[model samples]
Target: RDIAPSDVLAAREAGATGVVLEAGATNSHALILARSLGLPAVIAVAGLLSSVTDGDLIEVDGNSGEITIGETVPASAPVAAGRATPSATRSSAPPVTRTTDGRVVRLYANVGQTADVGVALAAGAEGVGVVRTEFLFLDEPPSEQDQYEVYREMADRLAGKPLVIRTLDAGGDKPLPYLPVAPEANPYLGLRGLRLSLAHTEVFRTQLRAILRAAVHGRIMLMYPMVTNAEEIALANEQLLAARTELAASGEEAGDVAVGAMIEVPAAALRAEALARHAAFLSVGTNDLAQYTLAADRNNAAVSYLYSQTHPAVLRLIQATVTGAHRRGRPVAICGEVAGDVDALPLLIGLDVDELSVAPHSLERVRAAIASLSYPECVARTEAHLRDV
Candidate 1:
């Protein structure tokens, strides 16, 4: 799919009416390709298979989960009516909000629950960026079988699209009573993410094995949360190797897996250049970064407002983190509250962010926001904003 852009354009040039694709591939790369090719696309809801055929001339009603096939009437199964294709609706062409200049940006959504998949598609998200897999384990310490079932269900919903499955980020704010973690004076800065995973070796290994196992069914990327240093990333990878070795000994098969790190802690963000060399990719958890940098507790009402994404310090940290990752020729994405903020959205685009993974509810607006500006305008605004910060 490296030449996917040209492929799409060729299809349009050949007079193809519409196209259907998996959700994950619908990110900025795919979206830009679609716009450039002038081909209207319909992304499936909840990773459901789209009924559009090559010659169907089908109408994709994204808002209502409907795809109308040919014949005098619309086909019922997984197809509906009253839905306008994205390109069709935009044919009239209205002025949009872009960077102070004008370059299109791409936006995505981060999913968690089963329902989020459909919501994201309906919101016009190109795809899901990060799927926090810990929620699947929190209900009860999921047995290995239970983990497999949940992963399978998630994979099915994601279809053939890319799903960045972050291995369980236990302890701290999201503590599991079954797996006890000792209290710390600073829980936020405590043994969370890879640190906790390493301490609870069994839990860590189980989750890693579960992810690797699930990768067989769909396009999957493995991510480590709350990673602060290269050693932590190495330790997580070591445990992953251990899991694979154990599986191989058991004669079980594992699928392709890419190990990446979460740049949340200031330390991790600052060291992103070195860390990216080890990680396949990088994603910033701006919520925690904001809290950590501003000395504000996200859960505390007293200083919650101080946990501002627009703050100069917070923006600078994010810019630095993105710069560090890009310098290493690695792609980095943002999966934080700021990703959905309309005002902050432009700022992030300006910062040269590779992806903006936001909530499902904000997808269409975010995409439209990004589409309004050009890359050059965003870069200039981003530079000026960073300087002001």
Candidate 2:
């Protein structure tokens, strides 16, 4: 053992205690040397550290891989040998959207993968606000039935809860390697979402077929993203109708599915009232709204920090979109990273958002925050905070 000769010296100098060593690639000699020094030691479990982030005051249950942050109680906490068995706990309960008066607001998760569907439900999501079906069409494209199977599995797990599926939003940053899309210099400004899906008829047809197929099994709605004009909505409805016609010909009934669009771009946000006239609901993708509104590329690290959801201009647009949707009797939800921030929650509550979709990890913390503040206080505080920001 390399450190055997200096084990005592290391102890004296380093103030040694029980060492936690990663076993996968840890040097055996080092373990032996630490053992010689009479240091208590243990091997690191795979994936243990990966889940924990820096600056997170995390309570980790080694036995369950459960990590709780903020005020949320984790499902379980780690216990040492002979210690009392810890009661089952979760890092936090699912998040609740709060009104200014402290009324519970519906908060859901915008899931991308089937695996995430369970996580969102377990985290206390009211429903899956959004399911980007694009992930299903990656490489080695699965059959239409295969897509239906995945969607049905997720729908079954959600069990009567609202699940909004956005048909294949490919191209741009999410190009399919298998589908020969020529590299665009400005992919973000290029064809994507409903446009990409429509241009490629077979691709859009297959997705619509899969989604309609899954609709028979659950409470489902169809939504499109990156919409700019009314024609896109008209065209999208035509395609969906064609899908329904085809499914009926095949002896499969196309169940009722509400159609909607995302209000992300400035044009869409401006025309939200008109967009709502044609669609069932409107979801503001704040992530893209901020980027496109501020003319900032989120991926550009140089200016990424300047991306501010707190920007008054961006706030105005979001409020306008929410207000417009409500006026038209169309529900509005936000699916973005901002939904997870406790500070932003109040602002959102004040804005009268119908729902919020956030990451699973931040769910409980948000719930606790919501439970702590009344809607009036939240709005008052948000109003005051906006001035300072």
Candidate 3:
């Protein structure tokens, strides 16, 4: 029998923090559920069960398909030398993602918890890319005041470092039993992300109120996920304005905060200019974009071959997004697996993406890669279809 979303839910309910799936199950519903739950998972691992015995300590890195067993380990995960995390220890501040030719690229980290901030910062993350706020509601959502404190502490911990907080992005692959989430025929193409927020006004508003209140602590940025068009951005902003008004009436006001949109769906990416009109920034969530564009799930090992960021179509959309955002004076940051991908880096640089937000572990190598290559060469190689090396 194949695994289902319920299977992942059961694992989570049973307190399993991660999952290792067979090779063919990469794009399966179970994998989607694992990501939705923020549980670490390594997909399509060859001979996974045969290689492991019960009670053996195992670490699964979803970013890199590396599996480790036993307590003996290296001082750090694999990363290239030169301005690397360990090697960069001589400097007081983390180095920005920059090239050998004196070009600078901003690199941020995607964090789930507050402690993740320090680790990312230590690894040279310029800021926190995207914080999936859905985790705040996994075991019964927190009270508004409770969420405020959690968000406030995160800001305090960052201490002026930038933080991009994505509002609740539940539905489709992720459903909340505590909330009214009806089963759908095609969940991915159905309600989720920003769409879910607008549909569930109260839930969205409460999160906004908390985020707005917490904006006083750091360089906090509000991002709406899976936004498809200009209207959604506008409607979401209306709610935000009301939240601000409510806080004002109570004599406490949230400081200036920049609102942004996630360019994960094609509709948003295509009409980027329209969306940019209202958003202060645009971030591309390439994980969903790749799957949606290719019509193949990354978890489905059978068709996973079709899921590629290198495809010209995907690159075209990315190029279009960056061009549109820059035209409107808004910066675009890529916050997906592709952002951290070494092979995909040059193409991204060619496309002129403004920022890259990756997992903390990828910070060092990505920085090193940037330092190793000149931006002009990356662009020329990509343009001429020549080997980047």
Candidate 4:
């Protein structure tokens, strides 16, 4: 069964030590929440519910995705080979990370809530990479005032650090109860993100107004999700301008905010240059981009093997996105699970991404990995990887 983001948070509050789900994608919001909360989670466990009874003692090894049942292990039992035991301690990362060749890479945290901000700051995150605003609209869309309070609180907590707040990304995988949506055979490829926002102008405008109001408290950058074309960016910006105008007419003041686009669709990636003309910056959502590029559903176990962000095709899109944004003098950021991958650090740096936004828990490790890499070598490696593509 599919798990929600709030469900993961509730489980943590209820004293659950680990989570096992029969279904979920690696990039799913639930799994992301579990990771941010430091909860051990293993998803896509076939027959997980049927295999165990209520009273069965279960031991879960999240690192290895191993679930042991019906036996109590001795204290001296040997740990599985190649599997590292989980530790409660968190290592401190440097405030800044630079490549061996002296190129600096910005590291930010992808957070779902305000509480995650403290953890991200402690782990040396330069700023908040993205705040998944959809978490506040799960059951029902919150009132504009309520949304403003949450966004304002997040900004105040961050002080002057950049806060990249993504607009409500509902519809696919996360449909709002209050907002009726016609069922679709393939929701991921259907109305979602910016498409859904555009379809429901009232809801989208409400969110934009709140984000604009909250920007007064601190540095805030508004990012629209799932934008596929220059036209989508223009449409979203129109809504934003309307929100600003409404606020002005009401004698309410709003802070300045930079508008950006999320490049999650392959079509968007292919036309990144065109999108850059309308957006202040571009952030690549590699998880969705990879799946959409490969025509693989990330949530489906059958096609999971095909969802590789490092695939040549996916890399080409990333390269094109960076090239396009840079051409327009707009910076590009990678705010996906791929950004946190230690093995992919060199490729990302070589791709010349301006920022890397990963889970809060991965900030330290990713920073350390980047500090050890030579920018020149990374660039060469990236060139080699893109040579045939």
Instruction: Report the lDDT tens digits of candidate 1 across residue range 1-389.
Output: 12244355455546554556544223323333343232456653343344443335456553354666664433443433222233313323332324445543445567655656665555555556777665544556677666766766767776776678887776666666556778799877887777877888897788778877888887778898888889888888889899889888998788888778888898888888999999988888887788888998765545655767677778787788888889989888888767867777667876777877776655666666666666676567667777765
Point out where model 3 deviates above 4 Å.
1-19, 23-42, 46-53, 56-93, 385-389
Q: Which ten residues in a row have the lowest lDDT in candidate 1?
A: 80-89
Candidate closer to the true structure by TM-score (higher is better), 1 or 4? 4
Decide which is better by TM-score, 2 or 4.
4
TM-score versus the correct structure, for each prediction = 0.72, 0.74, 0.83, 0.91
In candidate 1, stretches whose alpha carbon ends up further than 4 angstroms from where it belongs are 1-106
| Candidate with better lDDT, 3 vs 4 | 4
lDDT of each: 0.68, 0.70, 0.77, 0.84
> lDDT of candidate 4?
0.84
User: Which is the winner by TM-score between candidate 1 and candidate 2?
Assistant: 2
Q: After superposition, how far is residue 349 of candidate 4 from its true place, in Å?
A: 0.7
**Candidate 4 residue-wise lDDT, 1-389, digit = tens:** 66877787676666566778888888776787677666677888889888876545567787798877766546565533221222313544566779987898988999887778877887778899899888756777788899999999888888899999999877776777756678899889898988988989998999899999999999999999999888888899899999999999998889999999999999888899999988999999998899899998877777888889888899899989999999999999999889989999899999999999988878778887898899989998988987877
Best by lDDT: 4
For candidate 2, write residues 228-249 as lDDT tens digits.
Answer: 8778999998988899899999
- Better lDDT candidate (1, 3): 3
